[model samples]
Target: MKVIVGLGNPGSEYAHTRHNIGFEVIDYLSEQESIRLTKNKFNALFGKGKIGDTDVLLVKPLTYMNASGEAVGPLLHFFKLDTADLLVIQDDMDLPIGKIRLRQKGSAGGHNGIKSVIQHVGTQEFARIKVGIGHPQHTREAVVRYVLQGFQGDDRAAIDAAIERSTSAVKAWLTQPFSQVMNMYNSNK
Candidate 1:
């Protein structure tokens, strides 16, 4: 079984924020599969279903962004799933807008959610897809505010495109190997 976790804060206030891109992707995937994320477990909102023969659990950690690791660790233990069977989707402020990057294993690059997951899992060997939200032109505080806020105009369109691409990429990842999925979707050129 594969567990696909999308990192973000919960609640309507954060619904359209750049930080909630992870949640947006997962929600799109759930809708495509006609699955409702009604199951609450391991400090997360999730649902179970098969995606192209791969048993999948779509998750949105209710532990919020920073402490996401706490929920992921226990859930993996309960399900007897290894790091290899996990995939995380999140927004990246460092990348240029509209770009997507997939990595098999790496550091969090200062993302608190990924940092927490690493701390709990005790490894960085999980697969991940990062949706670019672009960095702010001004100070760090501006970047924080921008991400926590919401996307609009062309930015919203980019986010929507990313979600559509992520749905395809994730479904491909479940059935095919990581390399294949990366080759097909992880492109900026």
Candidate 2:
């Protein structure tokens, strides 16, 4: 089975924030596939269903962003899945808003959630889709505040478009090879 994990903090307060874009994609996919995220396991909300002919598990880590690995690692272990069967969706401050990038494997590049996943999973070799959220000021406090805040006006429109593209990319991954999906989506950026 393929596992698609979207990283985000739990609670209504964080809903729609830039950091929650990953969760947004998972929500969109769930709605589109009629996959109900009714199961709570390994500190995550997840559901099982078919995407095309492929069996898929949609996951939203409830352990928040920084501790995401605590949930993901155990789930993969329970299912006897290798890192190759995982796909993580997350927001990226380094890319411009509305842009999306897919990578077969890489370091976290300062994303604590991805860092946590790498830590617990014990590897950097997993597929990931990053939705750009646009970086704010260089200050640490500014970055924190920016990611946790909701998008506004034009930014919101851009983010919405990005989310749609991200979901499409994810669906494509279910059927296509990771490298092919990366080439198809990354070239659009």
- What local distance difference test score does each model get? 0.90, 0.94
TM-score of the candidate numbered 1? 0.96
lDDT of 1 by residue, 82-131 (tens): 99999999999987776788888999998999999999999999999999
Instruction: Summarize candidate 2's per-residue lDDT along 1-189 as a digit string, tens digits.
Output: 999999899999999999999999999999999999999999999999999998899999999999999999999999999999999999999999989999999999999999999999999999999999999999999999999999999999999999899999998888889899888899944
- Residue 144 in model 2: shift from native, Å? 0.8
Give the clashing residue pairs of candidate 1, or none: none
- TM-score for every candidate vs. truth? 0.96, 0.98
**Model 1 lDDT, full chain set:** 0.90
Per lDDT, the best of the predicted structures is: 2
